[model samples]
Target: MDWIQGFLVFLSGICALLFLFRKFFFKSKLANKKGCDHNCDCH
Candidate 1:
């Protein structure tokens, strides 16, 4: 029972960290100009 509780706490910490990372670092739009397409010259 103690081990299970510890595992759950660790999992919760990892989930919280992932959520914060995504919230701060995830971008919703592309920064590059000219857009994305097979014919686009931008790399």
Candidate 2:
């Protein structure tokens, strides 16, 4: 039904948003010991 389709779309959108947030806002497992925002010679 139309409701089912809408629900699926909403769920997919939520998942996509969470994935994006985790990627940009969270540190990656592959990063070195220094991390991203840590003080270093990054500049």
**Could you tell me which 10 consecutive residues in candidate 2 have the lowest summed lDDT?**
24-33
Write down the TM-score of every candidate: 0.60, 0.60
**CA error at residue 21 for candidate 1, angstroms:** 0.3
Tens digits of lDDT, candidate 2, 3-27: 9999999999999999998875444
Q: Quick one: RMSD of model 2?
A: 5.1
lDDT of 2: 0.71
In candidate 1, what are the lDDT values of residues 1-43, reduced to their tens digit?
Answer: 9999999999999999999888644332332443655654445
Q: How far does residue 9 in candidate 2 sit from its true spot (Å)?
A: 0.2
Residue 25 CA error for candidate 2 (Å)? 1.5
| Candidate 2, residue 19: how far the Cα is off, in Å | 0.1
